[model samples]
Target: MKKMPVALMLAATVFAGVATYTVPAQAATNSVVKPELDEGMVKLEVYFSSYPPNNYSDENTGFNGWLVGVTPLPNGQYKGTYYGYMY
Candidate 1:
């Protein structure tokens, strides 16, 4: 009989997750989307910036890459496979 309660709880959790997950898909797709930066390098997206930023300002050029996947190697230098615009 105790198993019945545990089973119901598990079932409820699964249903809750599915219901919450599927509901978001119905929202209207907007313009924000991550392009194919590289082969599995999409995880390197740092930030979102506007084009023609300040007419020609180098500071606000655009969303430069991020240090997302960068890692510290044994050489004490951080390195990672990055794919994006950088100056």
Candidate 2:
């Protein structure tokens, strides 16, 4: 009877080991997106930056400015927040 318990425990251990090895670990990947605007659309040509922004000023002689970051979602849509102000 004791042998039966030992065998069961050994089987359980082996099963657990197999499960751990066979199941692959999954990781999520996130990518950042940058937005572009027509140069003539808005006068804020300078602020149309990429993922890591560098400039936050309008090329034209204007006070309007914008700072934004965009990320693509799994639903095939973009998700992000924006902050616009006049400088």
Candidate 3:
């Protein structure tokens, strides 16, 4: 009976060690690239608690915008970008 407890404790310690060793490697693999804008263009970034909304009304305001990308952040928010060219 005592052997069973000792074996379980050993297994947990080994698992914890493996988890700590691999976390940094996993984080390094996921890197975000910076967005680039070209001449005669503009970039706008916004954050949302959920998915971004459609920009159909932007045309009426003369922006003619569209979603460039949407990245989900670690803090339960979304980071989105809009790229548009003005008239």
Among the numbered candidates, top lDDT falls to 3
* Prediction 1 global C-alpha lDDT: 0.41
TM-score of every candidate: 0.28, 0.26, 0.42
- Candidate 3 residue-wise lDDT at 74: 95
Where model 3 places Cα greater than 4 Å from the true spot, the runs are 1-38, 56-64
Listing every candidate in turn, what is its Cα RMSD in Å to the true structure after a full C-alpha superposition?
Answer: 12.7, 14.2, 11.8
Q: Tens digits of per-residue lDDT for model 3 on 34-76?
A: 3466788777666889766534125555665556567789999
Instruction: Find the candidate with the highest TM-score and give its number.
Output: 3
Q: Which portions of model 1 miss their true places by more than 4 Å?
A: 1-4, 25-60, 64-87
Output the better candidate (2/3) by lDDT. 3
Global fold similarity of model 3 (TM-score):
0.42
- Model 2 TM: 0.26
Give per-residue CA lDDT, model 2, range 1-87, as digits (tens). 345688899999999999878842211122243355544434232212234242344446444434344445565654333333444
User: How would you encode candidate 1's per-residue C-alpha lDDT over 1-87 as one tens digit per residue?
Assistant: 445688899999999988878854214222234356664333332222221111121256443443223334455543332345534
10 residues in a row with least lDDT, candidate 3: 25-34
Give the candidate order by descending lDDT: 3, 2, 1
